[model samples]
Target: MTKPQGFVSKDRNLHVCKAEAAASASPADEQPLLGEPEQPKFLGIELVTLKKIIPLGLMFFCILFNYIILRDTKAVLSVTAQGSSAEIIPFSKTWVYLPMAIGFMLLYRKLANFLSKKALFYTVIVPFIAFFGAFGFVLYPLSNYIHPQEFADKLLNVLGPRFLGPCAILRIWSICLFYIMDELWGSVVIFVLFWGFATQITTVDDAKKFYLLFGLGANIALIFSGRTVKYFSMMRKILGRGVDGWAISLKAMMSIVVVMGLAICGLYWWVNTSVPLPTRSKKKEKLKMGIRRGA
Candidate 1:
């Protein structure tokens, strides 16, 4: 009799998962499917009867960290954009940006096929995180000066600038790029992939009973993110009084994003390494047979 997936031995250890044991034997393997498990400890407080519950906490933490930064990034961008409202183009009132979205989706399809999940995750996400870091110290400070009135005038001449102002054109252009990259952090990272990751390692039953606890992480992130945005706002106001307050705040926010990115990465590493998903049935049997033969 084969044990069901996510099987645990007699000790009823919350962390034990046969699939993880088999999969963890190798370093570079895909995460294993979830199996039936013993009741796991909830919040490390009360011992719950639900099976395969503990490991999913790792997934929850990852989601929490992702939102803590991504949501904050959205707020930061909004604040920055508001501060520089004079520069923003009024194209948002129109549907002119639809073509660009269509173009991006077309490109995204090809890249999804070409890149492995891990590689694709890094390729898309790492750069965005790095951008936040670089933006903090670099692009943001020079932003007001970067797109001069001269360049805006040249763009107006060549691009058929109708009713929009030159500064507005430059601001809109910068914002478009920022919006695409920032949106991807949520779309590709959280909704598309991360949710799938949670589903991959959890059974329907376990997910149903305990998912609410997992969802609580989002609220925690929301609260923490609000505070983070507030702190940055205050710091920018007090410290950046002599200089550009908005620029200073943008930098501070981006730096925080980088730090959160690091924490997320470390949590991801721990999730994969320590609480790995279950491996295939055959692999487990093979390993067991080999061990018995060796003994």
Candidate 2:
């Protein structure tokens, strides 16, 4: 019983194509494992190196703006709840967000069956942008009519720290909704969507180089957000107090938030198209070159 002309010893690669037979003969066993070397450095920080980290850096920039808005929007809502003066714990913030986390996780799990990580990312981005746009342009303006300040003040005596209650505002429920939204965005957007998209684009080797810097980049956004708030306040001053200045400021900030969301989507598109992360089919080819099964 003779073997066929181009048959191989390996069970898996036995049926491999003629051109690829030599390559797939021993996919994972052939490469010599080497110790990590001192990465090439120019200024203590590997400014000039043998790898690409710029795409990760761009992803981090998008995360910076996204997370900053998540932080400040929550801060603004918390402040607004006490008439822009103080904050009240409307039930434990922790308790409020826990069920939200569970629900989001369930939604994401279901969506994962039908959508790629990229699609899930946009699904998250679009709704939030639409909500903020409506808030800035329409709902916020009608807030006084929808949930009047006079009504809020009447409740002040029952729930008071001062002249107003701990949770007294023209749109009391809207403030709480935004507060909860901010929490959900931090959980879903930062931890799930951004990282899920990042994982698709990154390899273990790439993670070693970029993940720390990614964290540092996001934290720095905290410093910039104060300056951003100041700039918007200036915009309000220029627009004039009696002429719906806060609305002008909110609209301007919301416009920038939409742009940041676009930047994240664009970066995801670029990483997927231009750099092209490996798929399962490509992974077989790479394994032929040296990568181990679990490595």
Candidate 3:
């Protein structure tokens, strides 16, 4: 006997469904044996991933390159500031740097309310570049006139020889200022600004893959900056002892720092504008919403 029409149609549909399922499964079942083709990669990263990672690595390289040069230069200037010695460093860290850091944090919080992350970055970094430029060209040249040598002498006498650390810090206040600002650049710019920016835009998977190379870039910076410092150090011999080699080195180093600072800003702007950063649009919207709420 023939089946009813409704039942016949239902049976036909069931067969079609089974056939579709089997067809889907056949490829999945064979997938393991056939093996998926490997993605084309460069230096262990796919091209798509490299596009995101390269700019970030280059930015890190510039940041760290300037940081190391400034760090080494600051140490030299502070320690060799006539009356100052290594003893002043601990005192400066405790008495000077800590307070400056706290003040800067408070200022940064206020700035965050008023600015976008990109604007905030430029605000923070431009001042550092300006300060270093001014120090190298103008302030260092006027150190003898600006430094409070007589007051430091009187204070030292009053406090006795044991207070030389504090006295030296006061005597070469410009150098101390440079030292504190250098410390802040490392803490604020490198650690807080650059890494914070990196973490905000990068996904967990991308960060894991990219951060290792970012670290590699920093290591390269260390080597490069060391060589740069050594080459400048050896410049004194070529120019003779009479030409004030340290001054020349400071000017040259600051010039490089300024150039690198500009490079960093350029890289940051390009990444913000050009890269297809994840959640970047969301970040901008949130920033705008925050500003509106603040207003």
* 1 versus 3: better lDDT goes to: 3
Candidate 1 residue-wise lDDT, 46-114, digit = tens: 243233354445545545565565555654463356224432423432333455545545655556656
Score candidate 2 by lDDT.
Answer: 0.63
Model 3 TM-score on a 0 to 1 scale:
0.79
Give per-residue lDDT, candidate 1, residue 18: 65
lDDT (C-alpha) at residue 118 in model 2 = 72
Q: Cα lDDT for residue 295, model 1?
A: 19
How does candidate 1 score on lDDT?
Answer: 0.57
Q: Give the higher-TM-score candidate: 1 or 3.
A: 3
Best-fitting candidate, scored by TM-score: 3
RMSD for each model, in Å, please?
A: 13.6, 10.4, 6.6
Ranking by TM-score: 3, 2, 1
Native-structure RMSD, model 2: 10.4
Q: After superposition, how far is residue 249 of candidate 1 from its true place, in Å?
A: 2.4
Query: Residue 261 lDDT in model 2?
Result: 71
**For residues 1-295, could you state the per-residue lDDT of candidate 3 as single tens digits?**
9899999999999999999987887532543335667556887666656666777788899989998999999988887888788898999999999998888877777788778889999999999999999999999989999999999999999999998888999899999989998998899888888888888768888886668777789899999999999999998779965698889999999999999999989988988887776754435343422433422
lDDT, candidates in the order shown: 0.57, 0.63, 0.85
